[model samples]
Target: MVKGYSNHEEQVFTKIAELRTSNYDSKSINDKIAENQNFSGIIGSLNLTVENYPELKANEEYKRLSENLVIIEDEIALSRKYYNGTIRDYQKFTQMFPNNLLAKLLKSPEFLMFEISENEKENIKI
Candidate 1:
């Protein structure tokens, strides 16, 4: 599980770096990351392995790492939720009466929400 996760993470980071070097915008880069099947599969596989292996689950190091991962994941989710909320508010503000005229004159770029695919919506076993 660790090997799979590490390899998938490396690949994702490499791809993101490459995309950034190629001048992809942040939203496009984020979309590419969200659509990465290998990364998603690795996460799913790790979750399954943990669920299936009682011994692994019982290991002190594994438990510690798992708890840390859970906390990090929750924090990331919260951050994403907060970011999306801010984007929504900004979009609404831009579309409102006086702000609409200013936005039109400035031609502001639309904010993209950090979205997860349907498969990502499933809870991880851990």
Candidate 2:
């Protein structure tokens, strides 16, 4: 679980870096979003496993890491909220009046709202 946690952490970081360098085009954004969710799922599994072990859960290092993870989770949630809000505003503008015509002419790509996968909504198998 520790190794998987570390591996996933690296993958999430790498994906974010790639997205930034790739100009955050639709494909890059989507990939980073997928990686973010995948990494969250991996952490969920780790937490589930830890829940069944009282000693490990009580460990100082584990507790500290868990606290940090919670902080990151909060930040990610906020980011998703902001991203979706921006998308809503963008869609409203792009779908209205003369702006719609200009948007169509520019071939602007549509952005999708961040959504959870079915697997993410499922209970993790121990």
Candidate 3:
């Protein structure tokens, strides 16, 4: 039972880590497109496992890592929601009339609201 539980935890954590890396990748691409330096590669490394690691995915440790990753992914999603909400609010405030005037006077750059695709919107839960 201990082994099973640990495996599950590892899997969840691994999934969460994967999701984080993916989000970082998305942000990196966005930054690159916005003329900023891409930094996603600094977070993690990737490769073709068959050629590089040779059946690493089939190993028990790797399986446990993958399972644990899923649980971690939920926490990441929550964190992202909080950040997205904050960014959205900042953007909205910057667009308001008096706030817009104040922002202009302060030379404040507008916050970029995070964009979610239609598929993401459709998948959102209350």
Candidate 4:
């Protein structure tokens, strides 16, 4: 068999494969989110790499792939927003006055907001 190129790339891709095969229900939210960040960061780095290559942009295939990646990134961002909104809605339902009493009786699960670690926040621009 032909050997792989970069060990780092292989490891990154392996993590991605694991993410695809693993059951989300079995993972803690933190684990799923860390995977999500790693996936997104890798995709972003690829996009940046493509943008840096004007010769690649000149090729129709590369242009098409870059466009597709951007669309995918946008969709992922939108989906995350929707997911966070859902969590907020659940929190509201469980925390409201009358509903809260019932929620307490039901032992409703606590929901966490979509939050970045302080280190990550420091790296974010605008």
Task: List all candidate RMSDs to the true structure.
Answer: 4.9, 5.0, 10.4, 5.2
Clashes of 4: 0
- The per-prediction tally of clashing pairs is 0, 0, 16, 0
What's the distance in Å from true for residue 112, model 2? 1.7
- Name the lDDT of candidate 1: 0.70
lDDT agreement of model 3 with the native: 0.51
Error of 1 at 61 (Å): 1.2
Candidate 4 lDDT: 0.65
lDDT tens readout by residue for model 3, 75-108? 6567657867887888789889999999889997
lDDT of 1 by residue, 6-26 (tens): 575586567656655654454
Which candidate number would show the highest TM-score if scored against the true structure?
A: 2
33: Cα error in model 2, Å:
1.5
Candidate 4 Cα misplacement greater than 4 A, ranges? 1-12, 51-54, 115-126
**lDDT of model 1, residue 7:** 70
lDDT score at residue 24, model 3, on the 0-100 scale: 58
- Best-first order by lDDT: 2, 1, 4, 3
Candidate 4, residues 7-90, lDDT tens digits: the string is 544665687787788897788776777677777666555444545455655678766876776687578768878879999988
Candidate no. 4 TM-score? 0.65
How should the candidates be ordered by TM-score, best one leading?
2, 4, 1, 3
lDDT of each: 0.70, 0.74, 0.51, 0.65
For model 4, name the residue pairs that clash.
none
Query: Using Cα atoms with residue i matched to residue i, what is each candidate's TM-score against the true structure?
Result: 0.64, 0.70, 0.46, 0.65
Per-residue C-alpha lDDT of model 2 across residues 33-118, encoded as one tens digit per residue: 77667667667866676666666666899879888877887788789999999999999999999999999999988876888778
